[model samples]
Target: MSNKRRRSIFEIFEEYFENLEKWTERFREALIEKPSWDHRACTMEPLSNIMVTPTEVIVTSDLPYAEENTIHVKPVSEDTIEILAKMKRKIRLDDFGITHYKGGFQTLRCQIRIPVSVDIDKMEVRFKRGIFEIRLPRKQERDI
Candidate 1:
């Protein structure tokens, strides 16, 4: 018969707590937002999702009124990317029943932080149906 010892109760509880801490950190990163000077004048936060895989990280953003040609994506840092999208038409605060802000905005901006190192030069991006997707390949150990 093979000899394999089962984990003790304390070991199980320790593993559980470790996993909980990891999950909490991931959740916090996903929900964190970077404040911008123009945020107060912005009307909407386009929903976004970041998916991390062994080989690459994919970031997708929903920009309802944005034009495909005006979308721009660039790496702000080794672990951060910036997105700028221009709407086809201006969006006024008055449209949302706020009269205090007189000027209209025609752009949407967002910044996303990736958890791992990525090769910015090899990144791929796509924009279709007012949605933008960015694929960033993880840097290899040798590249670092």
Candidate 2:
């Protein structure tokens, strides 16, 4: 007999949902071409990325000139987290020669959705060299 492993139906279902969630996130991002800066809020959406590993989901963002003490990462829901940080100095659009938009900003804000189940209580955060990192341990699955 050929040696091959078979997956259980529950495993298959779990995989399907995980893939669907990931695809949904990708599709939403691809469909929405939002500006990086919000003039009314005076906030900039910094560059961010998410990575899922077998043990944890890690999210990282680039927040240059951000004041470390003013950074906050809070879980707004089971699968959503909000990140906000205030910069040390205001950034004027005119400084970049954008005369049409006259505004100064000094904050960075972003909301992220975790693709997999994670233990938010055990989440860890670190900011260094203008890079912010968040690590949330994956919740252990209990067998049915």
Candidate 3:
């Protein structure tokens, strides 16, 4: 009898997963590596950081050239929030001495999801020295 091996179903699945892994890597590099600024929207995504504490969740963004009076924070949901602020002046690549890109941004904007429960109604905001900070009081837990 001639010896021949038939591929099992597990072998087929392994090949499929390998291809999926490669595709995911390509997708991450193509999308995640893009610039933060959106030229068409006239907006720049400011650098931000989030911290969760026992009593509050603190979110901050670096908003250089931003007009404090124009800053607006909107809570889209219990866990999601959006920040938008107008810049005091349009910022262009030329300001940084970059000649290849041609565009200017007039707004600072971003959306983020909070990882913990927070009381948005009592949230406090502050802007100083080009830093925007928001303090949301964490929801109090009750005994059932």
Candidate 4:
């Protein structure tokens, strides 16, 4: 490939400003738009490549395409629960060489219904990157 002509300073500035404005709009929309909850799964399934330990039930999900910070875990009921996560990143447009960053947010909502009811107040949820670990205490059967 031979060398090409250079772009003017004004052109560069224009493109930068355009992309900047686009990102600003996205952020504003995300903030102002009323959040509509979307359930990704009716129930949470066992992770394909995660470890579950004793004393607590550990569930790790591979969410490479999601943002770790947006992950939210809530106990819907005694045994049933839910997980929600989203991922965002800056990507280049294939058609236009424009550097507008499109959000790659992903929401994985899983409803977990265990064999026994869980105490939502004592539930613990920890998230790092796309991996989420939910530690839940095992329920003991009471004398009838």
Candidate 5:
């Protein structure tokens, strides 16, 4: 018979707790820092969601009016990533019923903090239909 091992109950619980902690941290960040336009210094905050798995972390954002060629994703640190995207057309404050701010914005900028360390070099980014998706592979621990 082939040798196969199943994870123990304790191991499963450990994994569940780790995931819970990670999601709790993310929820805290979201609540502490509102992603509204005013909180973002007049820049529009694109709605985003993050999903973490044992192998990778997936980040997705809704970037309306942004062009694929103008999108950029960079890993700022082991647990942070910066995203910038330029809109195809300028969005003026007047468009949002705010005439006092007499200027327009053409770019969107935001930073996302990952819950776990990731391999930036292996990260993959894709933009399609005004949506941006990023997949970052989790760093493997070396047993020494």
Candidate 6:
């Protein structure tokens, strides 16, 4: 008797969408359905883009289509400040669409450790152009 092998269904269909671009889209959608924690940022890094200068440190974040009063900032320690934001989810179909109530809560909380202690008394925070900037003064240095 002669030996014979049969190909599985997948082997036949593999040639149908042989292009890399066509297959890549399906692969990407499959990955999004089950998102992983790696999609999130590190805990220590600021929630958004930030810049620290010699005189002050600036932190910026953008939350468009968000109410002004939904943001909260708290000082956890002498050198750390935590920011928490709650944004309203939007619905394109209706004002109270089904999608709006589903996963309507969005939270971003991160503690920023300043290189120098911020003087809460003189601290300044500004929210403009969907950017939140916190200006903290540099600590005074004492000579030896």
Q: In what order do the candidates fall by TM-score, top score first?
A: 2, 3, 5, 1, 6, 4
Q: What is the full ranking by lDDT, best candidate first? A: 2, 3, 5, 1, 6, 4
Q: Candidate 1: global Cα-lDDT?
A: 0.81
Q: What digit string (tens of lDDT, one per residue) describes model 6 on residues 1-144?
A: 767777788975776657666778888887744421121331112246667787777766665544568777778987777776654553222334644322323444556777665566667877788777777776665768
lDDT of 2 at 85: 97
Best by lDDT: 2
TM-scores of all candidate predictions against the true structure: 0.67, 0.77, 0.74, 0.45, 0.69, 0.51
RMSD of each: 7.5, 9.2, 4.5, 19.9, 11.0, 12.6
By summed lDDT, the worst window of 10 consecutive residues in model 6 runs over 36-45
Decide which is better by TM-score, 5 or 6. Answer: 5
- Stretches of candidate 2 off by over 4 Å are 1-30
lDDT of 2 by residue, 1-144 (tens): 978789899999999999999999999999877888998999999999999999999999999889999999998987899999999999989989999977889999999999999988899999988999999999998879
User: Per model, how many backbone clashes are there?
Assistant: 0, 0, 0, 6, 0, 0
- Clashing residue pairs in candidate 4 (N, C-alpha, C atoms within 3 angstroms): 44-111, 67-86, 67-87, 78-118, 87-105, 87-106
lDDT (tens digit, per residue) of candidate 1 on 17-130? 999999999998888644322635554557788998989999999888888888888878877888888888888768879786565678888778899888888989998877
lDDT of each: 0.81, 0.93, 0.92, 0.57, 0.83, 0.59
Q: Report the lDDT tens digits of candidate 4 across residue range 15-87.
A: 9999999999999998956423222322223232323344456556655555666777776776666776654
Global fold similarity of model 2 (TM-score): 0.77
Where is model 5 more than 4 Å wrong at Cα? Answer: 1-35, 38-42, 100-102, 142-144
Question: Over the stretch 6-89, how does candidate 3's per-residue lDDT look in tens digits?
Answer: 889999899999999999999999987868899899899999999999899999999988999999999888789999999999
Clashing pairs in 6: none
Error of 3 at 71 (Å): 0.8
Best model number under TM-score: 2
